[model samples]
Target: MENVEESLELHDKYQFEVKFTYPLDKTVPYTEYNVETFMFIPNNLCVNHTTYTKDDFYSDMQKYIRLKTPTMLLKNILNDDKSPLKALKEAMKTLVSEPNNELKMLDYKYHLKMFCSIFKSALRDETIFAEKLNDKEDAEDYIKSIIDSTEDIVKKFRDLKDIIHVPGLENKCYALYLFADEFVSLSLDKYRYRMIFNLDKAEVKNKKKIRSELIDLLSAEIEYRKSARYNSCPDEKSDNEELIYRESTLKKLMGSVLFLKTQTMREGIYIEQIVMGLAAGLAMAFATAVAFLSQSKLENFTFSLFMIFVIAYIFKDRMKELTRIFFHRKIQKRLYDRKTNIYNSLNQKIGFCKERFAFFKEKDIPELIKKIRNKDYITELDNGYIGEDIIYSKRFIKILSKKCKNLLDDFNVDGINDIIRFNIRNFLGKMDNPTRPLFMPIEGDIKKIKGGRVYHLNMIIKYGMINKQDIYRKFRIILSRNGIKRIKEIPLTI
Candidate 1:
């Protein structure tokens, strides 16, 4: 009786049939049967649903997946009582309401995961998204919106500061202000995220532990800004005048202005001997002219007069030599007075400052300064005498100050050191070796020389050297005390 009941049930199950129809109109049919009935008849089951493919299932699944993912939704929303799955279903319906490629792809969970990963990565390393974000002019407006929002938070914090005694809030507030300041200062070429990151590192990281240090740095920067040291638009009035004067002055002083005395005086002594010889010739010529005129022969008188005239011409050249000597003395005196005035002025300034000029190496001019005093132009009793004067006189100082005050104002001890080095090289070049080139290698090239290869050459010529032309180039007499000491330390040489 149990076998009979099973057979009846099997027959009822085998009575139903199933079929599948593809989009191409091909159809497959099958009869449903129990395991026992399948022995008697060929049994096949065709399983088919709506026309949706695997891709369609994935597309539908993505919308629900994104809505369910923890990172995609806000923390507060994800924590609510509603089931994430149920919420996702509703979200998917809303999301797919619009038809687009993004909407079409939203159904796939992998697609959603990929999208979320890309978004997160972009937020983490904003350089990846910078181009996309900054492609529009409205990017600035978007950034301003974020800044405005942050400002509101700052305002709220400030408002609560009186009521709530937050110990570390002040530092935090300062850090925020620094961040805002840096953000506003950023250029369009710079990535906003980098600026923010730098600001956080520079300001926020040390704000709590090294509050005073951070504040001090900020304070100094603020003070510098207030002083207009880095002003983008400098005071145009000062700049314009400085520019005009620099152009005009440099143009005026373009070429060498020869002071004749130095050249003429050196050549004068030789010319004087020539003048005396010419004077003797003139006396001889006068005697001849008188002798010839007494003869009263017209041709001889004319010839003698011409000869006298030639001798007179030679004498006239000697007058030019004498005139030059007189003028050279006068010019030398004037130049000495000018140099003395400048030295006295500089000495006074240096004395008041109690800082000795590095080049001079003297507190005051010594009483036994015989070399300078021996000059015909300078008197031993002259109170204006400071010492052997520098080539940089009052006019040079004034002109340099006016033209390069901007540079000097920015100068430091290192710049002064460079100036000293430059002046030393210049002074050395001028002293008894003006034509012999000074060959100091550039700093980069200096390192290429082996240690043992380098050597020093120091020579002192007391009376200067005589050249092949028998011309005696005068010894440069204007050495500072330091210069004299430096020269004396070395043995004398030609």
Candidate 2:
């Protein structure tokens, strides 16, 4: 399962923690801070906000599988005094519903890091667009959205900055969150019965088993920490924005705008140089005409006309260059202006979004991931997970030449067939280890090498095993991340 920390924008891809922190400030210390944190229940904010635990969902899933209304079944089951599954239900409930100190800390840290992360992402998005734009309307909606989202983002960011600060603290919080999320995933995996079909579960057990164990280790860390500092002392910890990063949003935006202006300035100078060359050529042509008219002699007049022709000929390319430069610059600026307008609007939107972070509704960003469980119980209702298994399919789309077909064709002319008959298994044995390629025993695509072709069949290692005797083995292996499948061989070049 992917780490739950990635759900928040503050973390990197599959990362849970921030590299730096703001010193955590509280009335006493960590204990007095409000502990309730965000929960991950995709697309269903109501569920995320509620007190419902994973065990409750498990019971609901069982109802879903039985084709009964979950609400109705839950009501009836809760009232029942003697159900065989009741004890198991109660045990799973504690895993989710019980107060876990480590989990609480994770929730708190994520909430804080997410505020800063979202803010930076929005700002960066707007700034990148601003450079591409030259007109107003293209970025109209995008800018509006940024502005609409910014204020609420910034307000909450301030709230987070006030308390959560420590260089390495966010990393721990993210780690804790991952462990907690993974534990919950494992609980759901049990209901899915992923291990039942895997005969190799002993060697490659379900990933959830390891995730559960990790959560145990993380929980132990918090449970055994030196609580004496927070519980016994009344010292106040002060946090400030300076603890995290130095640059402000406005400063970053200014830097981007400056860079765009610099490019425009260089383009303008190049156009100016083209214009100067054209002007110099025209001036020389005019001077030659004047000199011809003043001399009046037929010979001198003819000479002056020839000189004018030479000047024009010499500047022919210059004239063309000037026209091209002027036309291109005009068209480019026109296009750039349209995009610039959009980016400016987007920039404004981001600024507005940043300023008002506190008042926005929670879950403003709609859920992108919709699977609620391993089996996605909402859509797959009444269909219990049966799991999948490794199966093979084969294909042979390519054929090798007669010379390449015989593994011993080039090497052992006298005993080529005998060599295959005696040590064919040994050649096949070499193919078993994926680190080395299966030697093609023929030349191919010689341009890649310095001289003679030393070709090796390009087979993917993780796909499956290959054998040197192509006449005996005509198919190749196809595999997914789970296990190998067989595929028919495509034609191979000699």
Best-performing candidate as measured by TM-score: 1
TM-score of each: 0.20, 0.16
Query: For candidate 2, what is the lDDT?
Result: 0.27
lDDT tens readout by residue for model 1, 18-104: 111101101212111111010000011011122323233222211000001122221222233432223333433443443333543
Once fitted onto the true fold, the runs of candidate 2 whose alpha carbons sit more than 4 angstroms away are 1-114, 117-274, 298-494
Kindly report which residue stretches of model 1 are placed more than 4 angstroms away from their true locations once superposed. Answer: 1-300, 334-367, 370-425, 428-494
Residues 1-494, candidate 2, lDDT per residue (tens digit)? 11001011112211121111111111221111001111211221122213333233222211000000011121222233422123223322332343355655533433322222223333444534533454445433433343333333323322332232234344554343333322222222221232222212323233355335434533433342223121211113734343122223322322231111101112234545666666556655655665565456545546666775666556654656666566655644322110111012113210000000011122332232111112235323322232211111121111111222222121111110000000111112212232333333345532332222111111211111122211211223232222232333434232
Worst 10 residues of 1 by lDDT: 36-45
Error of 2 at 268 (Å): 4.3
- What's model 1's overall lDDT? 0.27
